[model samples]
Structures are given as structure tokens and as C-alpha cells.
Target: MSLNIYHEARSEPQIGQLAVAHVTLNRASQSKQTVEQVVTAPKQFSWTFLQKSYVPKETDIFVDCIQTAMKAMTSKDFTKGATFYHRHDVRPKWAQSKTYVAKYGEHLFYRN
Candidate 1:
């Protein structure tokens, strides 16, 4: 989960990292899968599909992501149950049907 948050939203602010973390948690709960399953599922998180090492190189940022992942587990979800998100620069076809929830840092959040 920390790796997902780091690779996906490391450039984002703390709030955005939290949002991504919550999306992971929300997906896990909704899909009846564990966090690892939700994170490693095919085509779910881009980092998983990208042909590269999963090791986090930025130690400081990775630590921050780990903290964000922990905080998200106990904090109230400000995303209002967003199950999907994408970087602000791209528009995925799937996003057209999902309700726009909010934007935090470089990511936009959505929910079905």
C-alpha cells in the first residue's frame, strides 16, 4: 500500500497521498479482497504494470507515503468514497461514467 501511494502520488501533497491510500482501502473492502490483492490486481495500479522494479528509491518520500498510508486507515475519507483516480494530465474513458469527487494535488478522484 505504501509503495502504491509512493509511486502513484509521491509528487502530490499529503492530502493527495491520503486520497490514493483511501482508494486502495476502499477498493479492497468493496471487492472483498485483501490490500495486497487490490494493489497487485492486473491493470489496477500503473506501478504494478510498469516494467520496472517495485523498490522505492526515494527513501524520504517513501517514508512519507508509509505514514500517509497509515494515517488514511484511521482518518475520515475526504474523498467521499472515491474508488478511482487518475493523474490530472490524463483522461481515462472509464472516468466519463464515474462521478467526479475532488482534486488533490496532481490527481482527480472519482466514484461509481
Candidate 2:
């Protein structure tokens, strides 16, 4: 099994959609299933853990990076918005490890 990540264009420019990278799973239990695991924006994730010193802005580049990374992992092609990481202090260790990295300009953020 694999996880895919990609991006899609929304009706508005600022409001982007960070969709699944779209991966094909090789499972004996079933033929195929397309699941949409929606998540919050990357910036939103950071606010939970970051301080006043760190501020994150949403950018197309950052979103693209997330999509690229997810596609690379799943080997599936998609044009969805990129994936990003947010840090919340109360989360578990396993949850934190399931994050993906998205880069905005010169900065990078993690996505779950």
C-alpha cells in the first residue's frame, strides 16, 4: 500500500485545495477505493506549535511541493494542491511521524 499527494485548483486563488496524492494500492482485500482524507491548511497546523517569532504564509510553491512529494511517494500523477505539515503539542509520536514537508519560498513546514 502507498499514499499519494497532489493539488487541485479552487474557485478562489487564496483558498487552495490540498488533496490526496492519489496512490494505487496493491491489496488482496479489495480491488480499489478512493478515499478523501481532508486536512487543514499548512499554516493552520503550525499555529498550534509555533510562537510569535514564527509566522507562516500560504504560497503556491509550498502547496506544489507538497503535491510533488506525495506523487513521488505513490508514483501517481495528479495536479492537486501540495501537502504541508503542522505541529500540535498534544499529538502522539506516531501522528507526528506521518507528516510531509512543504516548502514555501525559503522556508519549510511539515504536514500531517
Q: Which candidate is the best by TM-score?
A: 1
Cα RMSD (angstroms) for every candidate in the order listed: 0.8, 11.7
lDDT of 2 by residue, 15-101 (tens): 122222221111111233323222222332332234422222445545554555454455542322233322222344544564444
Report the C-alpha displacement of residue 22, candidate 2, in angstroms: 8.3
Please report how far candidate 1 places residue 9 from its true position, in Å. Answer: 0.3
In candidate 1, what are the lDDT values of residues 1-104, reduced to their tens digit? 99999889899889889999999999998999999999999999998998646898999989988889999998998889999999889989999999999999
List, in order, the clash count of every candidate structure: 0, 16
Query: Model 2, residue 16: what's the lDDT?
Result: 21
TM-score of each: 0.97, 0.21
Q: Where does the lowest 10-residue lDDT sum fall in candidate 2?
A: 20-29
Report lDDT (Cα) of residue 58, candidate 2.
42
Screening candidate 1 with a backbone cut-off below 3 angstroms (N, C-alpha, C), the clashing residue pairs are none
After best superposition, candidate 1 residue 76: deviation in angstroms? 1.1
Alpha carbon lDDT at 89, candidate 2: 26
